[model samples]
Target: MSQATPPRSRRVPRAERREEILAAAARVFGSKGYRAGSLAEVAEQVGITHAGVLHHFGSKDRLLWEVLEYRDRVDVEHLEGQHIPGGLELFRHLVTTARRNADRRGIVQAYTVLTGEAVTDGHPAADRARTRFGVLREDIASALRTVADERGVDLAEQDAVRAASAVIGVMDGLQTQWLLDPEVVDLAESTAFAIEAILRAVLPGVEPLPDSPGASGAP
Candidate 1:
């Protein structure tokens, strides 16, 4: 009998293939960091050539950007209406996200790695990181202002921005510590505590949400 040729692998749809590539790239970059990770490694994970990845993403820089965007998409994927919440609900949403993140180490790793790398001079992700922080600061600040208004408090704009920065700083700082020593740092609990503390400092006399983790008498 004549030798039979093996059938080629089935082709993945363009959209599906892009998702696979993004996922594989996230893992590679998360473990290796963006500067250390390679397109070849990302390609290997997806069972494709390095050129195949380029064909899909155009360039490594673009791929890194897309991966960051993909992370943001995942963050809000579970939200109702697929959008970030505003006002007091935003704070609750953040606490819920931190709790959810405890189970998503890889995604958190990718975010931390990329954010750290974005601080370097001439980094491709510098602009994106800066823009992201600016937007988040504004969003959080706006939320704080809304809460203040609801409580009949006159919160200054600068104070709101300051509190927003502190909130973001504590969250990012805790992620680094947790990634280094998860056994010692409870990412979700510590995040809830820090956020509550910041809110208390910024909005004195306002009570925490009834169901918040910090409302359970967490120190």
Candidate 2:
């Protein structure tokens, strides 16, 4: 009798394969800093060759940028309409995200690692990181201004920018500490407290910003 022929492997869809590669790359770069992680390791995890990874992403630099964008997508994945909130709602959304992030250590780790790496001289992700910070600061400052306007309080532009920077700094600093010792630092609760304090300081005499409708119900 003739030997039975082996079945051919099924091919994954392009979009699905790209997502798989992105996830694998995130884990690799999370565990091993971007400078240390290799495309071959990502390919090995995805059961593909290094050349296959390049075929999808062109270069490791492009792949790194894609991975960063993928992380941003995940950030708003749970929001209704995938839209980030503004005004007081933005603060609530941020606290909600911090709460959600406690369960997503891998993504948080990847973010923290890449951010730290981006500060190095001539880093490939330096520009991307800088742009991300600039956008976040602007968004947060805009939100602060909105809250101030709604409360009939006048918030100076520089003050709003400074407050925004403080909020961002606290959140990122807490993430780093929590990653190192989860048993000691409560990332979600601490973030909420810090944000609330900042708001109270910035908008003195204003009643606490009421939660947006159904905001409490967000996961």
Best by TM-score: 1
Per-model CA lDDT versus the true structure: 0.79, 0.79
The number of the candidate with the highest lDDT is 2
What TM-score would you give candidate 2 relative to the actual structure? Answer: 0.76
Off by over 4 Å in 1: 1-16, 24-48, 58-65, 209-219
* Candidate 1 lDDT by residue in tens digits, 1-219: 012111226578899889988888877776676567899988877777899899999998778778878866766666676667778777887777677666656557767877898999999779989999999999899999999998988898999999999999998889889988999999988988888888888788866643333222232
RMSD of each: 6.6, 6.2
Per-residue error (Å), model 2, residue 16: 4.9
Least accurate stretch of 10 residues (summed lDDT) in model 1?
A: 1-10
Model 2 lDDT tens row, 1-219: 012111225488899889988888877775676577899988877877899899999997778778878866766766677767788888887887777667667557667877898999999789989998999899899999998998898898888998999999999999999989999999988988888888777878745543334534344
- Determine which window of 10 residues in candidate 2 has minimal summed lDDT: 1-10
